[model samples]
Target: MPQPPIVHTHRKPLVYALVWASLPAATLAQEAQPTVLDAIQVSAERGEPASESTSSYTAASSRTALKLALSHRETPQSVSVITRKQMDDFAQTDVNDVLEGTTGVTVESVETDRTYYTSRGFNIDNFQYDGVGLPAVYDNVQGDLDTAFYDRVEVLRGANGLMTGIGNPSATVNFIRKRPTVANRASVAVTGGSYDNRRIVGDVSGAVTASGKVRGRVVAGYQNRDSYLDRYNNEKQMFYGVVEADLTATTVLTLGHASQTSDTDSPLWGALPLFYSDGSPTHYQRSTSTSADWSYWDNVQHNSFAELSQQLGGGWQAKGSVLRLEKDSDSELFYQYGTPDRQTGEGLFAYPSQYELNTEQWVADAYATGPFSLVGRIHELVLGATWSRSETVDESRYGQGIGTALPPLEEWTGSYPKPTFDNGISGSDWTDKQTSTYAAVRWTLADPLTAITGVRLTWLDSEGVSYGLSKATRYNAVETPYAGLIYDLSHNHSVYASYTEIFKPQTEVDRDRNRLDPIDGVNYEVGLKSDYRAGRLKSTVAVFHTEQDNLAEAAGTFDNSVDSYYRGVDGLTSEGIELELAGEVSDRVQLFAGYTYVDIDTANGHTAKPSIPAHLAQLRATWRVPGTTGLALGSQVRWQSAIRQNQGTVSGGPNDGQPIVTRQSSYAVLDVMARYDFARNWRAQLNVNNVTDEKYIESLKKFGTSAQGFYGAPTNANVTVSWTY
Candidate 1:
């Protein structure tokens, strides 16, 4: 990413117009004095780009947690930034893949194409494009965004209601896009891997005007690959283009567009059954898949955005941005689940389903920041406003009759005949709208102590019409406040304490068939942040506690003639501690390591959330050979404690008399990478994942007796060759 300098000024349009009007005369004068023009060009080229940073793996500053740029030591919340170098070394291709290696974050796949991310015992439902927040909906189409067009991904842990108007208390993820650069640059790469995988990518960027004030960039990529599973294959295509212009010395303008499409054939709808009809656990091969040959899932996304930034006098700046996003998806899937007889596989069943959805969203935000004098002390202040709206239309259909019987397990193949179905019924049409005004101030209370306080006034409205239901919900004039205090223990160490709030509207119904009120919560955290080796290395140790009320849970029982309902729980609490270290440890060594422990419980203990491990740790290190130039090797290790799901009791089956307390034993995975600059302008690299080929379950259903668990990927490797010009 490359950005123009931040400008703070008034009368931006007038200033730019005057500058453009004088360009001809300035050019003529410069032509007459070549020496003066050369000096000016050199000075201009020396100016640093706003988006490019000198840090190798650590970020110097971020604006995701708060709308103001702050360093890691200054921010009160835990933040993780994955830079371009890390993504390339880890071979991360998509948003989900990147988060999988991120600290304190967990990724789970419900199906082949549907993925979910969680942090600190809650689901992460807040996402941003640049600095603008977007609606977070848990649809299959929203989680497969590609990372080719992004420069980096930033994750802020814990509650962030000050910036994101309505969201869960987990965390917020921000994707920063790449921008045009002032200098000419181009690169191309080709990759080949196991399962017949192949991919190619090209990028080009340069100035379009002789004055070097106007620049443009374009990136394109294509990939096609076969999976380890039978009959499963995927193809992806992506494109991105951006144009930037220096309207004036103090003003910059940017416009960009991006698009991605994924086409997957023979996609799996669900995992295979875990138990046999005789109450015995069954074992399946790592490559076993429950998909039919006719299954397919296809999705397409398009995004367009514009931004304007102006430098105001006296350390002040103003910036504004608008973004529009549209996504469409169509999927046809076949699922296999049900107990199978030990010998005949008599009870095996198949389910076929299809769905289509179209979603569109628009977001706009503007902010101004500058220094102000209060009580003879200069303080930093920021004020901003944001508006967002989203709408989704979906249609779906499922097989009407009873499940179709499948062949014996030993004789089953993936070439089942495609089933014919009727036209799908209209599913749901919904719209969400939100608006907010926010302000924050960095108060200089003393020489070594500073306080940050912020507040947001929000208005939200949601309306929807479903197959057999219609409803409207509104939260008007809600207020969320934030407060934090930081004390410098030393030049390289800081201790901070912060408090934040959370507000999320739930659609769950009560025993009377009425929707429950919104859930409210508060988060408290105390942490120590440190920077070493001139900010090249960063580390944090934090402890956090969160409590929520009015949590919706299942009611004891429901009347046969009426729909089931939920009841609000009085108390729900989650406590956790996290430790992380990331960045270059030495000139030849780069390292990243993290550890987390979390405990969550409900007042009644009967409705506790599951699938969250009690402990998790991750470590990765890369070393460049001291004697061999352009040669580097890296290794990574990830481990998690056991995860248990309390399924309560089985209903009516071979294991009816037993309790379904399913547990997945602890697991660990290893990965290795090597890169060598074999030539002047060319390089080759290899990445091997799951080095030991560990086999384990990645996700398990509450009722483990059912067939609803996902398996981890087996060992695989890829080789890539890249060229730069």
Candidate 2:
């Protein structure tokens, strides 16, 4: 995406006055002058614009960690921002697709509808919207989440304890929504591609009142597509609308609503068998599937929010916001297990079931930030508080045949008789609540030195019943401390170091049938950051080390009730190094690239997390043809080291009690794209992914004789046509 005209974050009379002041000079000029220069100069006085239409891969500043607007050179963390333009160029319409291209992040597509993410050798459980945290009730993405309603995705790598109540030490992902604009503008896009894929999206934003005091925006889209896997398809619909009103000269009120639905057919419940009866790895075609013709999983989600902000005197501001989120899912699925014969393909079984789950959450937060002077030096301080409550309910129904043996695999199709769901039903109900207060300050210690320190106090309570077990937990006055220092090495270079603590509440119990204490850890990092090309380009080199205690590990023992238990493992450590560069290299060339290397020490000869690769690399760039007007070319390359999983023993087959293993060697994927602008307001783009058609497994952790595993997509192409006014 190319850079668009810049605009102010908050629309006010001062913006209108500045625009009018520049108009006269532009009108009197002999040659037509680009008005974007004037807009950029004026918008610079205010905060940087969101990445909505910036068309650049880098952001000028972000406040995802401590609610302070600081540039990458000033912040003491590694961050990656996926801009809207990058999404359009690569056709990354889903969150999984986007994160797969990010730096130091891994997307684990364990199942068709269930996904997991990890970073720096830890699981990611923290997610935010426009700087506000929202806990994941299920700790997994249950369905495909579209990106049509978001302007950009900000990824902060490493532990973030101040903002997110539960610090997981993995990463934090923040989604920034598209807001209403003071200028009237509209755009529509139509796309079609391989597998009979089809989609259409529309966006309209402008002033609702003649005086521009009130503004509104609307975005809607629909997509239907077939997958490379056999007997699988999905349809999606999404809508978002927001309105902003300037109630007074220095006060603003905003309201927004967003909804999305996913309807999928033949979604997989469990993956194909990865090993044969001979204890050897099994290979299948890329188009192979384990779903029945009648199996389906559907999901819907709705979100509503309201915010009010007041600009106080002397550079001080106060803001309050509330958000409500609801989600529901329904599925009827079939699971297959057992290793079959390598020659005759026999000895497999099936289990059928139905499930329904629902989740509701409410979150609200308020904060005040401004500058203060002490000892003839100026500094900044922020104070905030947050409250959140989430409830989840689920029910499961088993079919008549608990475990029915299957026919020969070679002759078997998804043509089994639908079992009668006459068995009894079981359900679970759980609720969790959290309250937190935090304070942070930035002190200008010297001419070239700066320091930031903060702390958070959190209270947690959870209660409910899971299956036939009781679930109750409580914790009070959990304190997490944060501190950082930065020293300016030069006008455009800086060196920094930071230390932070992490805490996560676990649901598993110890062998004694007692709920284990929460997991706690600490992180230390130091890095060098530099800016070039007048802040249009940025680079960072960081080294991080994390030490964790009280991590849950399987005890390999069952309690009196036959339920599995776990024990706390301490002294686990992970250390890594990261390198990144993003932004325009020159007038006609732009690039974003990164490389990450991590090493883990289990500290007790425990089986390490083999699914996380030791090395990762991502490269994306775009170049404009010098002689050809309105023509550009781009490409993306991603590579990762080998990953493997050790499945204990083949069960219930000719190779019973035999060791099995699944592995995917190191590989790289390449994608190419071309875009052409034909008319004043129209353009067309073509994107081809996996150009080499590399065949690889999407995830290895979910691999076993019966559980989960899938293949990545093959060579595919899509064409998009867009018009803007």
Candidate 3:
């Protein structure tokens, strides 16, 4: 349950750094006034340049690792920033779209309303808002999280044990919210795209008081879209509002709320079969739908938060925040199983059910950061504590006629009768409480070398009933440590190494019905980073290794046991290398590019998690038209290596017991964009994605003869018009 230090860097800086290299010569020559000094200080402390108005593809600095603002060249691990400009240029409306374009990350859209993300051969379960952590929803994201309310998204690509509870070695995602601006600003955008997709968004921010000490901001958006799949449609609405007040010269207060709702019709519970009864692959039209007409999935989420900050003088500050989040899910789903006959189009059966889930979480955090003189040199330190509690309840109802055979596939129209849910609810209720205290220090070991060391102590307790089974456990003083060293080779380059640890509690039971112990892991990373054009452009080459112990491996059920069990595993390792370059490339060009390679193996030398691609590459670039005003063009390409999974043969058939392997070959997708400004405050843009109309599967696990395999989206285009003031 170890969590990150809750340092509130969103406030004004406690100190200032004066660097003349990156600044314009004219501005740098005459900027010693107190007001100008404050502006410069704020730029250094805000973690990163606010991406809302910046048209750059990269940021100057970020603090996702230890809450200490550091430039990209100083961080010891890999990090990526998805800016608002990039999102707008590419029409990235949701979290899934943003992550799919990021380097070294994969978005696994396994179903219509659910998604999972992976990096470095592990699942990403750590998510944060600003600096506060949010508990994941059972290891997956279940709703459509829009990006209209965020200023930017920062992704740390390694074990961030110092700043998260689970210490997952995969990655951590931090969403920075758009704050109220002192200057009045407003914008509105309308977009239309393929598949009957239409969207509109509005944003307003300005001073709410005569003295300009109080400011408020609001953002709202609505979207309706129909998919290429038959009978599938989705509608979503999102809202965000925030207010800020300066109570004193050195004290500030902020309050905010956010809500979103999503509704989908004919949402699929499972994918189409990949193989036929004769042991050959089955091909279906891209528009085919296996979901029943009555099936639907609906989700809603709400978040409320408040924070207070005060300046204590002497380059020190203190901050505290509280957040509460609630989520609800409802669904009626249809699933089809069994491989069909190639000639007869028979052998498929249906299973239908109704399900509901509700989850709520609360977190309170406070921290202090300041500068100290250590051995005649200035260093920084952060001390903080966090407390959080989460509760989840879920239930499912079995519908009548769950095992009815489907009609012939060639003529299927999803006209199966809706089933009646007469069975009682059957599900689980669970709760978790965690408390943690952490401290970290950045030591100025030398003029060109710095060391970062931190430790966290956590206490966790869980108690509740889960599916007719007892779920009671306690852990105390779970200590996790972090260490890193950064050596500056020059003003524009650095080399770094880091070590961190992470742990996760397990609920899987053994054959004897005993709960398995928590899984633990460690991560090691070394990299070289280069900065160009005064940090306007950056590059990184990193090599990383991760190891996990006590992993859970599935074990078949024993006598009288209806549920399958698992045993502890040891020595699971993943190693990888990553290369990335991002930021302004030239006077009239901007770019973001990356390549990743990863391999996972068990102790016995066999490959693990084969469904994940071993190679990934991406490039996105934009260029201003030569000798033209307010005109730009962009292009993007994403490619991944082949992936495969073995599903075993169909039962009671001629090929029974034979190996069934499903594979997806290497594929690449291309996208293009064009934008023009006809007026000072008005502009229009167009984007075309998957220009090649590549046909490929989105994911491979749980995809075989019986069920579960989804196709990627086909060629699509969208146009947006916006006016700003």
Candidate 4:
């Protein structure tokens, strides 16, 4: 049946123009507002920002770190940069909110900043800053970085053998610190909303000396928020400062420090059972209150960085960075498991436990890159070497295995009624030391094309100390290779491709008790780039493939596992196509859209690899009425294909082909935001997330034959107010 079409009532141009003019006049007479430029500051190199579009190429501009960390397209590898402008507009506090829509990037929330990033089919446990590489502390020590401290984030999509030599060929992320500019600016903000939350933040930066040689920037913030999960609440505060000095006409040095502390009322190791005699979601009946006396823990993090650069004679320049990062977490945790009863509202539990944990990590590195001459010809080159070491120690044993549901909601606090694994996982320690040497160069084969080649060799040694035994494994030096090309399609566009090597040392050993060969990976990628704005719009589309050898398989847990818990290089493959379009339609209207199609397979014969999805699409549009400059509105839509659970069943169960439950059902999520210019120095904005209130599962904790579930959150939004003087 066709519906009737029809009526167009048009407002006269004279009337519309008159209303538009009157509105602004009235606003100006009653309130003075900030300029539109106040909401955004972009470092879109080459006038075009890199997004997921195949038509443009983008690179991180040393500024705008976390702000546009999710937007840029720079390398043949898929890279996402979420900009501070985007963060301010959406008031994104958690990194999860900023990355949930990235192509091939899955943001799985275990808790607040404990969210994890999974690409293709693996977790990113190594991260770099400036030029320093750090061991990503997840299991034992995990912490969050306040977005306010970053200028921008640079992401290289494939094996970053040249930058961070220890990780996957799947991806790498770098956080570039914000430097002091030759300008003075200061701002502050306060916020309040759902769950009795409150927060405050401040940012200050500018030239501190008359000569502008000595400049500094600082950012500090604090927040307290109660959550909806039982025994869950989070409070945090952070301080970040950076200072720079120009000692000579051609030399620059920068020193910076960041520190943060967070106390969580309660954080679950994993959700309780989600099923009972019948199959249904238990979350619906569980207590909304958090534990009264539980401690997820209060953690602190610190990063110290120093960088120096000098211009040698000729076209040669050398730069290097020395940095260190530390994370510490200590807490006691207890909780029960179960699905909520359909009628009683009480969650039924099948297992429960009490535990305590303490974790710490520290890493340091230094490297340099520059251009030089070989013979009489000029050679664009990069040369560097680095060393890193880390140690992880955990203490505990388990308790009595839980066999039934948890008690009533009122009994939410206290030590676990019975613990598992005996005394708990106590006196467990693992230490690793790695060193790398690398050198690379880019040659201009012609006016239209450039080629890059590089290699990294690393040596690794790790030891486990526990009980009365210490087991150690040492890997002789291993060499990794790389090569890439960029062919200019034109001044504003290019066709580029590259192949790079990757490797990750095994934490668990193989049969015969020898350290297994590291997992090796190779990445291949090709794409195009563009520049549209006098220097603003950016776009890109590309295809990538990665093959990893010796993927891990657990015969047991991260601790006690059966012999040969690790396998030799088998076959693990991932291939995908990505596209993105972003930039200004006008000074007031901005648009960004991205799409990703993936084809990933596991020779181990599993279908779904953890958090990776097959398809993802997203679009966002912001329209600041051209004439009514005081008001702005924006909307976004994100969708992904259904995810398969690749878990195989055992004896009484099934095989590998059987997937776990759908944790993320390729559902479309919506988000909205609006900003109002209240006065010259103040602005107000509202942000809404998960607007559709869709029911989804984020992850499933499987214990052999037992599988329990945890439900994802529905709609959650917050409001923000800001001011400047």
lDDT of 2 by residue, 1-725 (tens): 22222211232353243223222221333344433321111111223586765778788788887787888877888888888878887888999988998899888887888888989988787888888866687567888999999988899998888887787788999888889998999999999999989999999999999999999999999999999888889999999999999999888999999999998998877677777777787778888777778888999999899999888866778889998889999998887766778887776788778889999888999988876554445677788899999898999887777568887645556787888776767778989898998877777889889888777778887888766555676777676777788999999999999888878888767766666677888999899999999988899899999999988765644631223577887888889899999988999888989999988778874546777898999999999999998999999999999988776676666767877777889999999999999999999999999999999888875422223477889999999999999
State the C-alpha lDDT per candidate: 0.77, 0.82, 0.82, 0.60
Least well predicted 10-residue stretch by lDDT in candidate 2:
37-46
Ranking by TM-score: 3, 2, 1, 4
**Residue 37 in model 4: lDDT:** 25
**Could you tell me the lDDT of residue 655 within candidate 4?**
32
Model 1 C-alpha lDDT per residue in residues 478-594, reported as the tens digit of each score:
766777889999999999998877777766676665668778878899999999999889999999998988876655335422124677876898888999999989998888888
* Candidate 4 lDDT over residue span 387-477, tens digit each: 7777766554444554545565444454444344454344557776778776665555677766666666677776775433343656655
Who is ahead in lDDT, 2 or 4?
A: 2
Which pairs of residues collide in candidate 3?
Answer: 4-163
Candidate 2 wrong stretches, greater than 4 Å: 1-48, 408-410, 510-514, 554-567, 605-607, 650-658, 702-707
